[model samples]
Target chain A: MTSRRQLLKSAVLGGGAGVVAATALGSLGPEAAFGAAAPDVEPGAPDPDFAEGRIRSIKDNTLLVLGSNMVFHNIRVVDGTSLWKLGPTTFDQAKPGDGLYARGVRMPDGVLAAESVWLNIVNIKGHVSNITSEKIHLDHKGQEVLCHRVAGKSIAVYSDAPPSADLSLLRVGQHVQILGAWRPDTNEVDIATVFSPH
Target chain B: MARSQPTDPPIDLQAAVRGEVSWFCCGTAWGPCSSTGKGACGTCNSGNLQHAWPNTSDACWAITRPDSCGFALSRRTCGFQHRITALCSGTSVVTSIADCGPQTDLFCGERSCCGATCATDRIIDLTPAAYSRIASLSTGLRPCEISTP
Candidate 1:
């Protein structure tokens, strides 16, 4: 299977040109592919189509989730549904206690037919307290976070510079933001991208 | 009440309100979040300066429903720019609305405190590019002020 790190490189390096080409073709014909259409939900109401929470159980191809706010969600995953964990993964990789964010069409029965599901994803801002060969220690508003670096997957973008797969430019005491996959039930995360000032 | 037009004049940044802000990842990454691709506006990127408001459209409001937590929010659609200032560091950044989130009701009255400042209620979520500009990524949430840029 193609790993998510490879996907990230392709999307960042190649997706831009592809998107531009698709947009050009879309302008020439109404039927040209332009990606998914916007949802038709009401103007000021909560979206019934998206759900985020922790997995309570997995039954058949469905996930019973408990939201961070105490709400319950029933999410269905079909063959077309895309699942992501540390990388592009499958539903079988999911387990109870996994935090998730899913987008799909909410069925009339109140179940969400998920089109995409991301597990343990987290984006946070923090101060780089220390950096070692294996991990970067961060102070996030007084909370400690350990960010593990994934080779070929973790990238860094400094200031307005383009993204590079190099982490050598990072330093201690700098404030940075990280986008990564959170380890289930931990204060640690697998780094995907790190944004920092030059 | 009728919603404000996208082309309406920019709201004053100084008069903006206070809330707790957090960050989230989307677009071109490992795992399931990679499929999120561009967010609801088809324009959101983890590399771009963008944000998700509780109420971007009626559909988004239906999901976030800040009102359920006793916080009423305006219907600001995608591409609407809001300038957010980090209260602790006095740092600020301007980000456009890219998605809907923070499920304010889930953490109703939830607060994040730093030093002498504390912010209650989850109000806004930002992209990595935007949040890192004004704060550190290790900090899960920070107190912030929101206003139109």
Candidate 2:
């Protein structure tokens, strides 16, 4: 089977490189790829490396974010920093109250020199209340959410197993988690992935 | 249970603790996020049974700084299994630590209440696959219990 990892590689690095990588690491399971051990850092310290949270304030190009843990982050967006919302976007589009996840080189002064910032990305836990070739209907916390599947983009993983491009594994009343781009101010989302334990 | 796999173990309920959970995505469908590709763990996909925890490594812990908020999370490495249960519906899903996230320190005192149930402290962030398994992506945050299986 064409594992989701291979499909992701192909999507990001092109088919040739993806195939090469797939062959090079064929014996390993997907989890094995993330199992490498790394050195430890100080306890209770700000990553000085990455940041995620709500935008508390924005002044000039700097964003003061309050993280979910109550930690504050000063994220500085440079020309090289990439921003995304429903799709690729610019920093000017960011607003207070927007949620963001940033990855960057932490400056000695403690500001996150953001390399990339994603806005309003959400992962929801819901049940596959309904499904069709084009969309999946979900009941999340008693609210209805419409998830549209993009061709060649959305995929699924079953019960900690390797991910596949198949959505056939999905069924009504089946619990699932969907990771996707949230369309701001709507009850809808673009499904990027679906996870089910089948 | 429709497409049941007999090989998979049963979901465990004994390992539960209440906290707040949210969701995030990589390999986006449009715009700049689309370039996010995978994640810190190259294998992270929105559709996979994955999640981001406050403490996945020394480096990750330093970043999330859950200690600043008085939550001491153990250093769990990538691919560690965690089962999150949504308090609103009691629905649950098992996910692996795919990356670091939901900076516990930022929302230290924050609480999410659903009916009579309320949870505080952002302890975990789920991939869409994991998050959608128990709650709505639109709700953004939910009260949940996390336990090992």
Candidate 3:
């Protein structure tokens, strides 16, 4: 019998899905696991298959979370789980008080069998207040948010164009929306994708 | 529980307004959103196709002056409908005003773009249900164009 540790190692090494399927854990198919699509429900209704909250504790592979609705949730993380912090990362990087949005299947016992977890991810709509070689200053709701650029990792999408790595088009005072990893306990974020409509 | 929809007041046809759009949770409390309360309308919910307009009231206008961003916004009461389109996806969702929000003046002159189409300032705040219909919840913000339905 393959141990859970071995299964995790294989899953991480083998690149995410085939091993989980072969091991009889549900298939994390392309459409379901990677699309990051939310369930079809009324606009303001809480999604049954989604959970958003802060991590209260971590026991082995299960995460104890206190949701925005004051509900308790147990999220079971596995090898197939795509954990993202500032960028693509591993599960061990998740810690207490880290905010998250998890999408997955809910088991019979109400445990969410997570497929993807985005940790401390925040999308900010702001104007470029200033720019330095290493960081972009964003004026968000009168607050200054220092956004750092990750070399070779940060990307941009300019008005209907495909995402590219060129950051030169970003002009000071341009309104931009940034998808980034929030540096907890601080006002900093590492840019992952920056979208400029113009 | 069954709920009655409020009758909408007559809308004055106007040109589409452009700006940044964001989401805020109301109704049932959750995490850092607990302080948001049930919104100014008292009927706000995260799961409804509702939104917050900066010009809902004089008090609200004091807090969210869109003019500070060089945009003039007309005042509309709760339950008035506005058709909002996401610049990124061109996805549209018609939502009614449920509360006052988005503090436009705070981030005056902010802009967002999708291509040749770009929007400036913070003009509206949508409920999770309304926003998620056009953009993902995790994204928190999007560039948008708003108009009367």
Among these predictions, the greatest TM-score belongs to 3
Chain B TM (all candidates): 0.86, 0.84, 0.87
Worst 10 residues of 2 chain B by lDDT: B1-10
Candidate 3 Cα outliers beyond 4 Å, as residue runs: A1-43, A68-70, B1-149
> In model 2, where do residues sit more than 4 Å from their true spots?
A1-198, B1-15
Task: Quote each prediction's TM-score.
Answer: 0.52, 0.42, 0.59
- Best-fitting candidate, scored by DockQ: 3
Q: List model 3 lDDT by residue over B6-74, tens digit each.
A: 233312234687788987767664333444567888878765678999878777777776666665677
> Cα lDDT of model 3 overall?
0.70
Error of 1 at B15 (Å): 19
* Candidate 2 local lDDT, A34-111, one digit each (tens): 222112222222233456667888998789988654678998765445566645578899998777776544555677
Model 3 CA lDDT for position A131 = 92
lDDT order, best first, reads 3, 1, 2
After superposition on all CA atoms, what RMSD does each candidate show versus the true structure?
Answer: 15.0, 16.2, 8.8
Per-model CA lDDT versus the true structure: 0.67, 0.64, 0.70
